[model samples]
Target: MSIKSASLTIVTPNLADTRKFYEEHFNARPVFDCGWYVVLRLTTPYQEPEICLMSPQEGMQAFTGGAFLNLLVEDADELHSELTEAGLTPMMPLEDHPWGDRGFGLLDPSGVIVYCYHPIAPSAGFEEYIIEQS
Candidate 1:
């Protein structure tokens, strides 16, 4: 089956702050916004994923500590520079990874990890971990 669109919903206590943080940092525009729920999207022609923010539900467990949003970009270094120039500090400095990624990470106001990355040549020993596609 072909997929039309996809979105990731993050339930947090700080919905407003999380929504505002995405708006400011990613140039996201609100497609829908209520007090409890907000959907934001980047201003792009291609079908990018939507980011949804919502209030925590009653009786639900606390936020998942290690959940992260990964955004693959064309130029991660440029985006890193832009983020830094916008007065935001990265949770992790941009660096090349053994798994063939050059990226950085940041935490939103609600402590959600956002990783911005782009693919690069894999490091030494990458071939050992490579999985052949079926």
Candidate 2:
């Protein structure tokens, strides 16, 4: 079956705060907004991932730890500067990785790690890990 679209729904204790955090940091605009949940559309057109913030209830469990999103951007350095200027502290400084990525990480208001990255030349021995696609 072909997939049409995909989205991630994050359960948090406070939906409004999480929604506001995404809006301010990622430039997400609300497509749907309710007291318990909010659906937002990322302003950048590079990737169309719908981010949904929902207040945890009965069966829903909030993600208290770990990485939740990996966003590939054109320029991680520029984005880092932008986020820093916006008063968000990156979990670590942007650095080149052995897997051919220059990126950094940050924790969102909900404690989810978001990795922002861009592909670059692979580090030494990284070519051995590459498998040719048919």
TM-score of 1: 0.87
> What local lDDT does model 1 show for residue 15?
82
Q: Put down candidate 1 lDDT per residue, 1-134, tens digits, no spaces.
A: 99888888888888888888888888899888877788899765655579988898788654666778898887899999999999999998999998889999999877878999998878778957878621
Model 1 residue runs over 4 Å out of place are 62-64, 132-134
lDDT tens readout by residue for model 2, 13-131: 86777788888888899998877888898888666678888888799788777655888888999999999998889987899999888999988878888899998988778978878
TM-score of each: 0.87, 0.89
Which one is best on TM-score?
2
Measured on C-alpha atoms, candidate 1 has an lDDT of: 0.85
TM-score attained by model 2 = 0.89
Q: Could you give the C-alpha RMSD of every candidate to the true structure, in order shown?
A: 2.3, 2.0
